[model samples]
Target: MTESLNISIQFGGGAELLFDKIKKREVDLPALKKYLPDCQREKWTIRELLLWIKENLLREREELFLQGDSVRPGILVLINDADWELCGELDYELQNRDTIMFISTLHGG
Candidate 1:
């Protein structure tokens, strides 16, 4: 059997399933898992994670992360060994057996 989405998280290289659940899951579960190791380790479903963050984390559009402030928190970001913005934006479509990477960066002296 083969999965429609096959992505890799460089540091440890974890396996994940990618699917956008508009209504079912309130949060971006797959994204949280892929990018945030802590979220994945907790084994949180997209629905759970999203609701949690919606109720816990996430701020206003003052600081947009993905896409042109339209996607809000667009999943399927591609960034390997680098930060989020550096990688391609949400425009990245679904690539068969695609290996997506999630990287968060911080800049300072």
Candidate 2:
């Protein structure tokens, strides 16, 4: 049997506005193998997590949150308090209990 992956998600610096002003969330993701038949890997990556968030959590303005399968520029992504860029960005495999944060750097003047 496949197990669910549990993780924490946070939005900040105006990014929360896209998620109904919610700053934090606890998400349980389904097994990758079962969730995506084409996926051969046993682990979840930030890329998949972003897709999941767009489908399940993002409230509106998807264009503002995502761009061509990744987060739009000006949004900073952190995994467990470290920059996602340091963690390999979309290729970084997600671990149970990992805390992922998205902070928007763009703001209208």
Candidate 3:
């Protein structure tokens, strides 16, 4: 049987605008070796997941959602309800059924 990583991704605080107003999505990501041949890592990390999301899930205006190799400066990331900063940020390894949320800190008053 093929192994899959199931995760829930969410957007809020105006971040949904970049995802076509879709606030939540369930994704089943193929194993790292199955999808990414150039990658040397076995486990999926937030860094890899961000790239995956940019390639697969992001619908439009990627600039509003990302900057360089990570989320734009004003965005906040959460992993399973805990601040991703405390969870190793981009180095955090993703787990099956993990919940990841991106919230944009920029919004009009």
All candidates' TM-scores? 0.26, 0.95, 0.94
Candidate 1 C-alpha lDDT tens digits along 1-109? 1222333322111111122212112222244345454543333332332343334443443233233332234243344434345534433333333343422242224
Off by over 4 Å in 2: none
Worst 10 residues of 1 by lDDT: 11-20
Please identify model 1 stretches exceeding 4 Å from their true place. Answer: 1-3, 9-88, 107-109
The 10-residue segment with the lowest total lDDT in model 2: 33-42
Q: Model 2: per-residue lDDT, tens digit, 7-95? A: 99999999999999999999889999878879867899999899889888999999998999899999999999999989999999999
Best by lDDT: 2
Show model 3 residue runs off by greater than 4 Å. Answer: none
TM-score of candidate 2 relative to the true fold: 0.95
Error of 3 at 24 (Å): 0.6
Q: Candidate 1 clashing pairs?
A: 27-50, 29-46
Candidates in descending lDDT order? 2, 3, 1
Candidate 2 residue pairs that clash: none
User: Can you give the lDDT of residue 94 in candidate 2?
Assistant: 92
Which lDDT value does model 2 have at 38?
90
Model 2 misses residue 15 by how many Å?
0.7
lDDT of 3 by residue, 1-109 (tens): 1488999999999899888889999999999988888888888999999999999888898988889889998899999999999999999999999999999998767
